[model samples]
Target: MITALSHPFFLHALLAGTAIALASGLVGYFLVLRAQTFTGDTLGHVAFTGAMAALAGGYDLRLGLFAATIGVALLLGALGRRGRPDDVVIGTLFSWILGLGTFFLTLYTTHRSSTQGNAGITVLFGSIYGLDATQTTTAVLIAAGITTAVLLLARPLLFASLDEAVAAARGVPATALGLGFLALAGACAAEVTQAVGSLLLLGLLAAPAGTAIRLTDRPYRALGLSAALAVLDLWAGLALSAQVPVLPPSFSIMAVTATCYAAAHLVGP
Candidate 1:
């Protein structure tokens, strides 16, 4: 297993995937507890359009996605809506970004001569074998940052997640917590989107967390289970992608993750 982490391509794939699994599981634990899954879904979809624009501009796609997601998150956090429907806000933002993406895609398609075949499909669905060492290192660093945040802010974050009213009453600063978490969520999605792509990103992030929740009511145990399951799913996906010809790696990972989720639902008590 460790040997696979040495081959140039496999090395990057393994590092990036495991790092993403850790980041997503850790951040997603809070996202799930706060019922911000919709926000995550929207931000990830926004990342797709951001990536497409980045490809067109000859910019680093991951950087572009991260910038866009961070911007969106700040905007949402700054709004700090009072008694408003959060879903509506997220949906509205998602529609605008996706529409912009569709327009850009049309331009890319019309320019055909300048477009690469790797544009939409490879980026949208992902190609795990394509990650390089630099990208893997970046993923590791970002995951480490997220993990540090979890360790440093766990008590307050969990307090805000479970009972914002009480936490705020106790001087927890729920608003600050929400804003901080928004930043964290954007950062998490940006890293994961680089490898899995926007389409399958949510599945990889949400499934493991969802499954972990099904397995245990205890938050810490659920987080550990989520990280473990997510790593297993990613490794299984990489192995399958290697063994199977003409099959995409994202499908393999997601399929295994889906199976895990279904099993959790069936066998969990």
Candidate 2:
């Protein structure tokens, strides 16, 4: 374990993973609290589609990733009542996004597969260990930006999530906060896609937040605890994968996350 720290790849994974986990924890807590877990899940499909679109268009994957997720998030806000994305809005978009993803996948596989065959796979399952120095730095910066934005919006967002009607009545700008949070969540989903891939994005986002919520009824405490648990899950998963090279880091990390969530259910309030 200590030996892995000296390696550049492991160090990069650790740093980037920690930053992503922090943002996921913060944003994910609100996602769960607001009953917006489905939105987060839908964004995973959006992430995959976006990446495929980028690949098909020969653009940078991040360009497609962020543009698609953020664009759809804003669209969801626009389509829903008071900027709060409801089940109907999310469900309607979900299948369309998946179909679009399929179209892009066909384009990529048919044309660019010879050159970038694994690109789609990378977006779906992640390639954290494959990150180079520049990618790692970029991931960390994006995660930091996301974390900062979520923190700034945390309080009002909390109020809005808990009770949109009351929050708007109290002049809390519920609509704007909801829109802002969805956008933040979109960005967070895009960032998480890089670390854990879209397949397990919800696990990283939900499990820690779910565990934290189970452990405490205090909102702020659960928020912080969510972030802490996510970081620990990332660290433990990475360490385990490092010790046992046969294990995939994403699977290991999510396994730890699942275990913690289950433990929370067993031992928590």
Candidate 3:
């Protein structure tokens, strides 16, 4: 295990995965508190469509997905402010984009180069072994930004989440908090897609936080435990997958997270 950390690829992958897990847990805690669990699944699928378009258009898939995800996040925030049910819109939009993805996927299938097709798979299922130094650095930067923002706004965000009506009355700017959290979550989803793929992003994103929240009520403890569990789930999954060679890393990671959540639920209030 110690030697594994020294290997270049393993080191980079570990770095990227750790940062991605931290950000996911932080943002996801707020997401659970705010009742935005659906946003994770929704933004993840949106990334899928953006990645497909990027594949067809010759752009960087991550950037394309990030841009599209941010746009969707902002739009959902606006819709929520206007009293629309964002999840309903998101649910409808998910199928629409997925349909578009399938159509383009079929279009690409006829003559798509294998390299381009592999990019599509990367978006769908992630490629941890493929992470490079630059990508790892980017993940770290994003994680740092997320941590800073969440720390600064945690109280207001929490206040709004626990009691929105009271928070709104207390000048907590609940709508702004909601939009901010959504935007943060969108960016975190984009980062997580780097490690776990869009399909299982929610599992990694929501599970740790959900479990942590159930185990504790204090803000700091909840966020800290969530991040720690996320790191455990992904890193253990990575190591186990490397050793076992039966299950895929992405699914294995999610399984670990789901098990944690289930354990927390079983020991419930």
Candidate 4:
């Protein structure tokens, strides 16, 4: 395990995964509080479509993933200002994005040669081992920005999440705060997609936070627990993957996360 840390790829994975886990844990607390796990899951699919579209257009995949997910988050927020998001609206957007994803995948396949075939798979399942120093730096910067934004908005956001009517009565910008948080969540989802892939990102984003909330009613303690558990999940997963070279790190990470969540349900307060 110690020897694995000496390898460059493992180091990059460690740094990138840690950054991603921290941001995800923080944002995920509010995501569950706001009852937006479905929104986060939807964004993952949107990310897949966006990445495929980018690949088809020969553009950087992150640009498309972030742009599309953030754009949709804003749209969802704008449409749901008066109340909770309508299931019909979410379903519509979900269908539209899935259709677009299929179209983009088809287009990419038609235009690109066999050498580019793995791009879609990479987008779907992630390619964390392929991350370089530059990408790791970018992930860290993005995570820092998101975490800072979350902290700055923590009190007001918490107020809004727990009781929106009261928050609004108290002059909190509930709508703006909600929108801002969703946008930040979208960015977090995009960054996480690079590590855990779009399909499995919900586990990384939600599991640790969910477990923490189950174990603790105090908000601050829950936040701390969430971040801690997320880091543990990431590190343990990486260590397992190192031991079993045949297995993918993302799979290992998600497995650990799921296991933790299950255990929390059984043993947590």
Report backbone clashes per prediction.
0, 0, 0, 0
Tens digits of per-residue lDDT, candidate 1, 18-103, equal 88887787787777777888888888887878877877676778877888888888777786556555788679878999899777
lDDT of each: 0.81, 0.91, 0.83, 0.91
Worst 10 residues of 4 by lDDT: 79-88
Where in model 1 is the C-alpha error above 4 Å? 1-6, 109-112
The candidate that wins on TM-score is 4
Task: Summarize candidate 3's per-residue lDDT along 1-269 as a digit string, tens digits.
Answer: 77666778878888889888887888888887777889788989888887777767767778877887888888888977787766677798778988888776666655566655566677889877688898889888988898788879988888888899999999999888888888888888888888989888989888999999899988879988988899999899888776766877787898889988999999978
Descending-lDDT candidate ranking: 2, 4, 3, 1
Off by over 4 Å in 2: 82-85
What is the lDDT for 105 in model 1? 65
- After the best TM-score superposition of candidate 1, give how far the Cα of residue 98 lies from its true spot, in angstroms: 0.3
Task: List candidate 3 stretches off by more than 4 Å.
Answer: 109-116
For TM-score, candidate 2 versus 3, the one ahead is 2
Global lDDT of model 3: 0.83
Query: What's the CA error at residue 216 for candidate 1, in Å?
Result: 0.7
Weakest lDDT window of 10 consecutive positions for candidate 3: 108-117
Which residue pairs collide in model 3, if any? none
Model 2, 1-269: lDDT tens digits are: 88999999999999999999999999999999988898899999999999999999999999999999999888887887655556886898788998999899889989986876677788898978988899989989999999999888888888888888998899999988888888999999999999999889999999999999999999999999999999999999999899889999998998999999999899985
- Cα lDDT over the full model 2: 0.91
Show where candidate 4 strays beyond 4 Å.
Answer: 82-84
Task: Name every residue pair that clashes in candidate 4.
Answer: none
Weakest 10 consecutive residues, lDDT, candidate 2? 80-89
